[model samples]
Target: MLASGLQQPAHGMEAEENPYLEIVKRNAFDLTNTPTNTQQKAPEPLKANDIKLTGIYLRNGVERAAIALIEKDKKNTKPTYLQLAVGEKQGTVEI
Candidate 1:
């Protein structure tokens, strides 16, 4: 003869009861302190026509990346000192 499955010990374990399920609350934290970030614009290469390299000198053994430059907008009269580095929109450019 065929035998049936066991249904005698089905209610053996107990279920857990949460106490704070009725009084749940949340708060919106202030985010004004967080700094806003923006993507940097691609830097355009220094136009050869607009800028003229005045001089390049080595200072001792240290890095001498600082070069004298003058933009055409100023009639090339004022020499604006600049460094030979990548110029980014977010970064300060020496003048």
Candidate 2:
């Protein structure tokens, strides 16, 4: 009779010793249905403190001001400017 080198493992012992067995169970999630947000909320309105007066200029009898709108959460970035005439109105502030 020929001698066999390998021995059969116990029924539940093979599953307990396997490392990749848990991978299948971990990835058993819903693949077809996914949750997502379709509606986006409106951005917050700028306040009075967020605006700054950078400079003022006078040319030919007309006066204008350079108004700077500071960006949120940025310190080193340049602010956006609006050139407005003496009596021009932007939002709630008058130049």
Candidate 3:
């Protein structure tokens, strides 16, 4: 029997005589020949704030120890300066 160009040979016929085999073969060929969809491009990076900064301080003297405690209380949230000079103005130190 033949329907829609597909052949179904009699039960005793050889496999090479079946028309359905041709249809299946053609479908397999088309499936392998078809192309896949293209991939999408990646988006560009925007200029945004993504950087972070952290600070840590250690001191041994009594005056430096007091400043370190104050820094701890503030959580060292912002950049700060500490001074230890008694007679002369010393340079600022970042913590």
Highest TM-score model number? 2
For candidate 2, the C-alpha RMSD (Å) to the true structure equals 11.3
lDDT of 3 by residue, 1-95 (tens): 44876756557557768777888877865676546867778998653322223333344632321122124345546534443433433333222
lDDT of 2 at 48: 42
* Tens digit per residue, CA lDDT, model 2, 1-95: 55486656436878788887777668777443555767889988755446888888987788889888876677578877788998899776687
Candidate 2 colliding pairs? none
Residues 1-95 of candidate 1 have per-residue lDDT tens digits of 44477434333242124334333323244345556776778999766424445555565653334555555567648666665533422123433
TM-score of 3: 0.20
Candidate 1 vs candidate 3, lDDT winner: 1
Give candidate 2's TM-score.
Answer: 0.39
Candidate 1 or 2, higher lDDT?
Answer: 2
Ranking by lDDT: 2, 1, 3
lDDT (0-100) at residue 20 of candidate 3? 75
lDDT winner: 2
